[model samples]
Target chain A: MTTSLKKFRCAALSVVKHDYVARGMAAHPRFELVVVADDPGVPDWIHQRNQKFADEFKIPYVRDVERALKEFHVDVAIVSPEAERHVDLSVRSAKLGLHVVQDKPLTPSRAEADRLLSEIEKSGVRFMMWNRNGLPAVQHAQAEVAAGRIGRPRSVHIDFYFAKDAGPPRGARKTDEQQCGWLEHQIAAHVDGSDGGLGSKPMGELMIEGIYPLAYLRMLTGAEVRRVYAQTASAFHQLYVDHQVDDLAAVSLELDGGLTATIAVGRIGAASHPSGGEIKLHLLGDAGALVIAEGKPDVGVYYRGQPERESRQRRIAAENDFILADNFAQAIDSGGPTMLDARASHAIFCTVEAALESSRTGKAVTVRTF
Target chain B: MTSFFVHTADEAPWRDAARRLHQSRLVAAAGEAHAEVFDGALLTKPPAIRAALEAGRHVLVAAEPCLPRVELDSLQRAAKQRSLLFALFNPDRFLASRQLLRKQIDGPLGSLELLRSHRWENHIAPAPLGLSGSLVGEIEQAAWFYGRPVRSVFAMQPAGLNAVQVQLCFGPGMATIDYCDALQGTTLTGYRSLSLIGSRGSAQVDDHTNTQLAYVGGDGPTGLTVGEGVRHLAAMLDDFASAIAEQRDFSSTVTDALHTLDVVAALQKSLKTHEPVTLEPAEAVR
Candidate 1:
């Protein structure tokens, strides 16, 4: 296959980096990792790790975004910063006339997302979110839906449940000043200003972690979320002390076209068996139903009086971040619309924000559509 | 030695199995000379069951006993007081799939985290069985593996009584059983799938068309083949006869059946309340 290689640069703005994005872009046939711009807030250890990654990929690491933009002359910027910094990084990259490929939650809040979109629109630069669900299986499901395999979809069910983090970071000792610095930065990044710097509460986790399944449902059904009713609770995880965030949440959504969907997400204790996790998505249409049961154990090993054993395999479709990057390159080259553009990300953010509000108020909230 | 009698409704699914068991002398049918044997459908005919129990006849129910809680409880108490050998026939307990699952659970399989069983049948006919009726056997199978009483039950019948999904929470683990009766345009009898997930290993028994057992974890992927015919029914009848003649408890006794019934009852109640229903402790039943 002929390769249409494009120069790709990334702004490593978040302390918590996604290795998959970097690896995926590097592995893509049409993309070349040109430069990595490091933000000031990134810790020293993270910088070292980023440097190692850049060196291994034969790319230069620049501490300043302006320097990288001017020196690398890149075509697109893969902005994988923290949720709050997404807009700032995207707007800066857009100002340099660079198309954008950004991570999830477009921005921490809808207002920031609007500003970021306005910048990209003014710059006339192509933009896409790293929607991992835009992979083969989900796209195939979308195709099946379009082909009338299941007729008109009436309802959708999506669930994502995983084991909670074992515990807080071990052997972590920092001065009061250092701890305060980290806490302040995290609190500012939180859209709701509820971040205690420990971890995201259930709502935040749902917005970030649950967005994949939600995005998949949206892509498959092609329905806008109209209203949302959500219920959330800190069902388990006694290890968390006074953590107001919920450990379990269930959201019912009414999509624009009279399609209803339910999204359930939770951080429960690990399965006593070898099963890695449970992710189920079922779409029921007037004609028939499509059921996708992912992360189910295909093989099980049992030893008497011991935990069940099984191998956990990553969803092959989810590993297509590289494909998303490749799509970004193609969109830039051909001047066409990408699969998950800024408008789609905006709608996803609105639905997720609505669900968060509904959970907090115990009332169904209407999703704001622009 | 006590000889038991088998009585079933003419159209009962187990009638042929009962006849086979009687022919093998594992059980005796009630005839002129078998006056010591019982009369009555242990599940349907309560009046006849009372009469037979009063006559000191050993009785075996060739069907799932679904009686009102009070009546079933009273009968169980009366049977215990009179030392009557009463058995509820659930041949699933004797299926090769079930036996293989039990052996795996008891030996190689570690502590179970979850177990899921699905059974689909066509409900177009005028059969008295619905989703809950079809699930009695699966519930017993799960309980046997759990080795504990179900703590609670949450159930939903999304398609009315035609389809049901029940979630049973045991002490530390849980199980879910989904039963559907809406299968159409299928000549096959039904579909049955079982999986046992534990910490150390897991196994799945697919008893559709062929009895296929596959396991992983402890000793790796071990496959076992077993028959899917009358052998299970024969084994169940053997247990019943042994329980009667040896005066010993059987694998699936009236109490065990009652436990499953209680869970089903709780599940049914949960369906109405839209909330999980906690079951009475197993110890309280006796």
Candidate 2:
């Protein structure tokens, strides 16, 4: 086919010094890294190290995230800022006619999330969510289902675990309006504040406390969260990930086919393994079932066998092949989809939205539960 | 709830069986041949089976039951609704069976009333679901006269060395691959997945999937397997074919082509539910 759009520059909003989402984009095989942030918050040693890495890699380093986009004339801006600033950045990117690969927890609110999604669509830019980690067997199961290997799918089950980084630098804490605008700044406060002598924070923040998990659920289901019930570790007091976030939750999802998916997730004291992220999904069909015990091939699944449950002893396959940088490369080469497509990413954000709603009320919430 | 419909090609042994069956007048019929349809299932007509399916609907058919699990499951869901399993049988015999009863021909429409009065409605439904089953052992070699074992592939578990015979079955794929092609006739299938305990059952002889059985140490070297081996293949083939023609005869009580799938689903359910399931009474024809 003809070249749809060839060779476009891209800007990242998160400060360059932190090897976070920007790092993901840089690693993609397709896209060429164009520009990144320059910040004083970056330690002298870290900045020197990273700047050299960026320079050696032939990527530009700019002081302000927005300035980098305006000067380079990139076709897209990866909205990697803290949850609070996503809306403004997304709107700005859409206005610039720049396609956006937005980070999840799209926005703290549904309306804003919808508006961003609508604008991106109207701007004629592709949108997608950014979920990393080979994630074990999820993709393979999806492919198998599409291939009709398994009959009509009826149920889906997911299990997940995550740890927090309490001592993050710069905009790490969910406080600055720029860093975590729509989300409340209650990580350490509410967690520590809710200790025996302390009381829970009266102010509710979606980003730090509720948004991520809710958005994630919505994204993975790839459907409107019709209804959901979630119970978080209500009285979480221990500090594990530098921040005191409710580390675990049990959530149930009922989809269109009268099919139900139950996800068990939460944080625990020191991990027994080295998985920073994980998702275990079991897909049930008429004849048999395909269980994705590991999210990616790089991940491993082992358990102290349950009584009646069979010993899960299979090896997970590899899917760590998706590099974030390729989003730009794909956007440039095939004129097809990039990992950073806009609406799909919005969907993932919407999941976090519903999850947050369910957690706060101690009741099941619909995707549009607003 | 499993059923098997045996078909014959003007063969004497089967003809004798039919003639003897008619002569005995016990569950017998009088005509050029006797045809019978049966419900043959254990579960309450599951919703999946009810939407469509009929018995004695086809003739001259074949069945291939070795579908990948997904297709198999889908078919089960669909057939389970009607509380029907499937096997093929001859259309002519079935249609003939519905005609005037030779012995009780006192009045014209007497047979209809008698059959209807007996709830033979299942006999008139469209043909049931059908599939092909591959057969490995040479059917001809195992005939009464030839009686060869080494030639019978899937043949194992020697019943008796006195008269000495063997026949083993692999997967249903080899049983009906070539004949299972999509043909003009409707097809019904019977798959008996029985676990006989006391007399002649072996664990290796799982009925639902294809299997082998040996009649070891019989009174006189077990004339059983050799009694009518060649026709057995034809009879099995005819059952699948007849269902495709919608002409299965509803004259016998034992398993037939129409009830094969029915029986299998039931037995499977038994295995699943840990309870014995039974088929419902056949409905009266409309």
Candidate 3:
């Protein structure tokens, strides 16, 4: 690695059904997708998908993770596997002294997330949880807070709704039909690009998508959540309802220094919004406030014969991936923390865990600290 | 069709509203008025409202009185015993934009799914619009649009901050009100955004669309002029008089205001207890 642009070789670890992260990393000039690899004991569909992605990129597909990491001589591992396998792959790659960039919802288990955090810290490898924190609007909000425009943000509210249908409506399924399976529906959802929470176990909206808004809150306020009170409902998508997971949720967070925050997240069907549903931030500071629409700096396209689904298409400029990649590279070179380090990611996971518990017990739960 | 006496404090926030009500065509302002319109004086002289009701006169409050539940019940009883019309002037309900939004909701917007209202004001110091009053007003506005009783209320007010965030659950649908009044700015301007997401379509009324920025000589753009001059108080007064003549209910009756007050009380209790307050359906007596 040099002060100049140091191009790094990136291993595509388990790009099964999710190649967006791998492709995003390869988009940057500093990273090159070297190989795709996963455990040989995994399912056949996983290997097929990995092979397909590897073939598309003209890279070899290896069945063994360790063998591929050692053979390819990669400097970074872009783990795009399921949520359950995120911490395992990241820890393995970090133990091999490779910087890691993993997917969202870090891991489903708290102990696993903590292990990955500890392992990453021990390895001294830069870890960046691929997030929307690098989006243009997110960056703008960060700049506003850093510039002291809002003056010690007192409250932060984020509305993150993904206007995409997961499956049938909440009550549309017949009483005699079989309940939807998590991995099966997720694999099917890939056809329409709605498999954001792709995994074996069922995940609520807060677990699958809480990181974005939580990262925004952490970035702006620089405070850890102390307590959380949450309300959840399976208001949409029978798939989530069948799994006893929430498609819509609102979480109230009490952070350090009495800074309060709220997050309203939902996977409300596509008909609810014109484009990708409203992603907004409402920040209240001691001296001033800011209301930001994350979809700004975009061009809206509407014409005859436009598809009725997401008819008013908003084409947002694509720079989040590049910025995230550049940030990771910078952190690796300078030994600085990435935009969202492993510690912050663990805190967000704990907060989400607490929110889930609060929703269950119907009482404010103190966030687990470790 | 009745003469109304407007009572306002020296620097009442609703003084302009009182003046507008006094200048309405259907209602006349006189010294010996048969009806009494109470503005910000409700905070200081709440007994005047009860006195007007007790004296067999109709009572109209300019803005949200934020009366306690017990006092509201007393006022309700006094007005009911005398067969007097007790109306609260909810100017937001009568705004042209709000009316248009309602029409859209009933027409093309289809069944409402989500509603979000953001009201931010640049009050250097704690001015007229307090947090509780604004919270009540916003809850009323949300209920008016949702047309459903709030099932639960969860509110959060950051310590040492003049702001309140409330999430109201209406069974399947939900509405959120994020209001902050302690915004610090050189120019005293406000921001309001109301978005209604329904099954079919969406309708939004954002103050940003109506605001104009002038790039004067400074480090940044200086002047932000919001063009909003909807005379809602006059319309409210006209409706009040028409309701009285036709023997019908005003657009926002005392029952609706009481329901709003109930929700506001639940929200306050939630703020204190740090738990969501479940509310039974409001039993309106009109």
lDDT of each candidate versus the true structure: 0.61, 0.38, 0.79
Top candidate by DockQ: 3
Please write out the lDDT profile of model 1 over residues B40-69, one tens digit for every residue: 223456676666767766556655535555
Q: Could you tell me the lDDT of residue A343 within candidate 1?
A: 76
DockQ by candidate, in order:
0.07, 0.01, 0.46
Each candidate's chain B TM-score?
A: 0.77, 0.22, 0.84
Across A124-216, the per-residue lDDT of candidate 3 in tens digits comes to: 999999888877788898899899987889888898888888888777889999988899999787767678788898999899899989998
**How high a TM-score does candidate 2 get?**
0.44
**Model 1: CA > 4 A from native:** A1-17, A65-76, A79-146, A150-323, A326-370, B1-28, B32-57, B60-65, B102-109, B124-131, B135-144, B149-162, B165-168, B184-189, B206-227, B249-286
Candidate 2 chain B least-lDDT 10 residues: B113-122
* Per-residue lDDT over A103-166 for candidate 2, one digit per residue giving the tens place of the 0 to 100 score: 6446655678778867876777656555543333554665667666546554444545432222
Q: Model 3: per-residue lDDT, tens digit, B115-216?
A: 888877665322232344655677888887877778788888887777888888777677878887755653667778888866555677887556677787
Per-residue error (Å), model 2, residue B35? 57
After superposition, candidate 2 runs with Cα above 4 Å error = A1-5, A16-18, A38-58, A133-136, A163-222, A234-245, A272-278, A295-341, B1-286
